[model samples]
Target: MKGIRAKLSTLLLTLLLLVPTMANAHTVSTTGPSPDLRSALGRLLGEHAILAVVAMQKGIDGAPDFRKAANALNQNTDDLTVAIASVYGKDGAAAFKTIWSSHIGYFVDYVKATAAKDEAGTKKAIADLEAYRMEQAKFFADANPYFDESIIASELKHHIDHLLSAFNNYANKNYTAAYKDAQTAYTHMFATGDALAAGIAKQFPSQYSDASSTNPASDLRSALEQKLGEHALLAVFAMQKGIDGKADFADIAASLNRNTDDITAAVASMYGKEAGEAFKTIWSSHIGYFVDYVKAMAAKDEAAAAKAVHQLEQYRMEQAKFFAGAIPSLSEQTLAEGLKMHIGHLLDAFNAYVAKDYAKAYADVRTAYSHMFPTGAALAAGIAAQFPEQFHTANTSSVPSVQKVWFQVKSNLLTIDGSKTTMDTMPFVNQGTTYIPLRYLAEGIGAKVVWDASDDSVWIIAGENKAEFWLGADFMEMNGQRIEIGDPIIMKDNRTQVPVRFIAALFGWDVRYNTTDWSITLTKAMAMEASSNHH
Candidate 1:
């Protein structure tokens, strides 16, 4: 048992370390509208939030990779320098860089203190972070001379608080709460990014006046990018559910988000917005259909599955019409290339899920989704055609982060110690007294079932015998086992959250999740096997 855990941990460490190497040696990313002061600062703050997460992850993982973490911190400081330079020119940017770098050092101290469990050191570290916030806020305002420091501090304070909470949650093993806070931190960062971009465009108009926020930088790209993000989330969950026959999906989602944003945006601009929307609607519909198709396929419903494919074909033609109508300059040939890319993404996700190759599925999902680049060029190109100088004159390619990072998977109700230990690691739901679907119960007896999408029926089989799963105003089957009372499967976030008891019993193990208190317990079957093997 220890050996397996060790193996998994080592693999995890290797994975986390690789992320920074691909991330340009932990340095800050500060491209796009560099002449705009506000945008520059926003990007800096955004990077800071990301760094904090990276730092926390490293701390928890207890990695020896200091250069990577430091590089990430340095990158953030570099962004700060960029913003200051834009606002206060060379002198100010240089001054702020030194002060900003100090916080990174202090953060390193904090991580050390945490590892040593030093109470006083922890307090001191926290104090340093607070001081960094106030001083940096003031410095930025002073650098700009015209902008108000108080407002900057106030706007950023909430975001900083969110980041701190996430770090704390991770420290305490409250991953569920940590992840919940993480969403807020990341989402709010985008707002800061947008504000900074707008501030830069507002401050250094000559260099960045042509940016636009309303339209993405281009018309050819919007729909594809949107679908890509959705695809990212889906691929992760599907793989996690074991519906895809591959490895973990979380890592894949992060990589995709980091790598593809630019490409998605560039491609969309070539097509236009209305056309993008048209593509998005059809593309999104297909994903839903694909999910339905999986259910039908699992059930061996040949007719239903065929019907799904037919509907998808119809959607493609209709989608083609929408693009043809919106794109005035690009003929069918150019559109065809872009269309193929979109189709490739969908096919990749669907086919991977169908094959149960979840790792490959996620790889495709990440590739497809994170490919959108929300840049000033794409935004400007689209706006240039419509509003001309009114929009083209303003630099506003401010792609704000999506706030609200609630747990999509692996939330907890309580911890082993009776505290809100963490809402991470795995998904959980509240136990309830409800009727059990026969197929769900049958799963415990060495059977698999498929849910029918069109009729919402569950088909089950176990060694030639057959049963079905019915929920909500449905009749009971005579053959399947009874699900114990007080452990009903609750539906949350589209996935059904079954009581741990059912899964453990069906799978020959023990499990528990206290959604009411936020805790989880699982005793795998292998543990007993290992014990027996040991004895």
Candidate 2:
């Protein structure tokens, strides 16, 4: 057992030093819009990465403040489950929590085993973690075919290895190695999160229809949403750490302040320098109020805490008025009510944290974080309404029935009608014409596709419109009239390929080809009205 343990430790440490750093970097454009799905997932997953390290460190140290770390981890779990529920429903989220929490338990077991110097127990814990890696890999792989099982399994192994190596190093008093591994582990999770989120978004595009939020036109809104939401999360975390007198309180507080700087810069980019500075002043004041409340609570000064709470209420009104003044469309009363909710949630979270009601405190943290999204949206909408020309092209129509198709070059994967579809033959560009599989295109456009092998012909029927084309035929019979299409129908990989433009013209749908991105967008004629109005 000792030999095996030594070998495993040596292997992990070698891998730790050898593993290439992952670049999980993302640039948030203050002038563009991004998909809300990415923003929300990034925040949740990033928080998970940070909280997991904090929890593990505290637990391994056997610190009295471990409870706070544990509570933060629980809060992150709750947030993750909520995010999963948003896409996969409540039952799916419950299943996710079970599988996810099991791995955390395995880590705890490993920590215990190490502390006791029990080699056999440590081996058992590692074996359990290996089992968990496969289980989680299968879960995500089965959830979306795009998430290849082998790839997921490999990545999960990396995650487990990094965590184990970090803990092992820490146990051996290799402080430098432990910290390095922990940082790598934390960074790796961001990539894992991006992959998972992209899979989920591709699997159910309808749920993430606001993909245009990341586009350059809506960058301001997306940036603000991320910055503001992170502020709420980090502020709550910092306040809790401060109340508990945790060692990382100063670092967490600085992070919260950095988020404020990011948000101020976002505002400045949109509203102007003066407005940004003013907004920063107002924002920083509220944070100070929260700090005052935390300090007062720490000292058990009831009167001081009450005074701080009153000041926060006044600050909320000031913030509401400021936002309302900036955006004429925004009602001051509505803003005040929203600000009140924000203040209430933050205060409640802090109060709950101080009282050791961790569950309630974390619940409030989720509430506060989620609340910022709508606030950002409202602010963005108001800005867009005021300056329509700047945001007109970025605004996507809120057409509930409209279907979107994103065709990528050399890829069989396509998002058809807001759902991912895999085709046997990929869409390709031959010369100047783009050819797509006839069957997939027809079905994607809500048309009935039928192939008659006897005549080597394909039939496309859509509500009183009928078109028939034969393989290798240059002309198609549309409603009994022969129309000469310059491009011949060809077979690619046993699938009949047709010119997208010809088929779109036959159905009276709009076809747009983007050469830069190699994407083709098809929108039904009926949906065009809503899209035009959106601009």
Candidate 3:
């Protein structure tokens, strides 16, 4: 999701680009928690082009951690660019990258100048960046420019000037102005970007089109929207922006739980009710697992962490299958790219948590959960084509998918106590004190239960479905699955009871477990579960 957010940041030119990822709108006024402009710009730059370029130049100029810094900045930029290319079309992003890369170079010079205390270098970098502004401004101007080039350019200049000043202040140890300047500078940049994208899409017919933008049909947009609608994210954002506060209350894209059900709705709209509901049920499960992760993190419970990770892995596998099976347009590679964005966001958010950067961690969390909306809606729409009745009840116009996912994720994670999610194939159903092979039950709940050795059983929990029961020889029941254990729980090398057929039939469809090779084969669906979530 961090990867997705970074990539999504590249989509627009201005508003989001110049600020923090998705933190609240704060001011120096101290009304509430708000980041001043400069800090916001630093955050944007950290992920986008500006910092990438500057860090390189700084490294080149003998900054102590120049190369290391460059690597960090570029790493972020690379992820961001890949994410953009995934959605905006590599060719289009290719064009943007070409232009974007050059600007970064220019910023590097600016940083070098500040380091040397060289007035001329500073002036030159400033001039070069200004030129970049002009060229980029014109590129966007060719598309839309928002207002007349002259007027918009004036605003752009003011914004840039403020940015330069902030940079200077930061260099000079003038923290106050530096923060102030940073805010103005980044916000200006965001404005320019927004204008640029809007102008380009609206104005240029032959080039710079808005084909795969924030609309509903394509997987690209679907994935992006999901990120936008995360729990209390868009809601909090909108609340901060006062969009939810508006009269008539037509659209509530950025608030908490005001009703985000777009993905299901979209799916239902396109397909039918049953499919939408299925998507929702599956989607909701993942949210619950993420919530579990947060809980584990807060409690510092290693056992809880392991359990959450296992569950998340299972959920990913199932979700992958859901996409592969349901979406006609998605290939395994396509699904990976889509899933990768979410995974990246999750990893990034967790990394922040581990690093104690609460602001960034939350920002990444917001993007990860919120971004799921579009995909959820699209899934719903597709489902609508299959089941119409439920689709109508879960219509397109609602809280938004990301928000719902957020709600679900938050609720589950916050409340997790000590639930264990076993990945064993041969589940022991305590029937008259005797255990039995519980393939019917494990497979019923979408888990690939495996028997290890000696006496232990490992259930490969895949997908969002969940259940619990002690398998027995006579009868077993867990999560709506009723079965009789026929085979005795055999002991393998070290683990325990091995249920070969049951788990193989159930989760094997998604993830194939080769007992002979002692390996787990992931189908296109199962392959989707290899996400490095925040632990």
What value of lDDT does candidate 3 attain over all alpha carbons?
A: 0.40
Tell me how far candidate 1 lies from the true structure as C-alpha RMSD in angstroms. Answer: 22.4
Q: Rank the candidates by TM-score, best first.
A: 2, 1, 3
- Poorest stretch of ten by lDDT in candidate 3: 401-410
TM-score of each candidate?
A: 0.42, 0.55, 0.32
Pairwise lDDT winner, candidates 1 and 3:
1
Q: Write the per-residue lDDT of candidate 1 for residues 415-532, one digit (tens) a residue.
A: 2212233332345423222122233233322346666677544555433333343443112221231212122334344433343323332222222223454333433211211111
Instruction: Give the distance in Å from residue 243's predicted Cα in candidate 1 to where it truly belongs.
Output: 17
Q: Please report, as a residue range, the 10-residue window in candidate 1 with the lowest summed lDDT.
A: 1-10
Question: Model 3, stretches more than 4 Å misplaced?
Answer: 1-147, 150-195, 201-260, 331-341, 344-348, 355-535
Residue 160 Cα positional deviation in candidate 1, in Å, after optimal superposition: 2.2
lDDT of 2 by residue, 9-80 (tens): 111111111111112213223231124565566567656655666567667778655676677677788888
For every model shown, the clashing-pair count is 70, 11, 97
RMSD of every prediction: 22.4, 19.5, 27.3
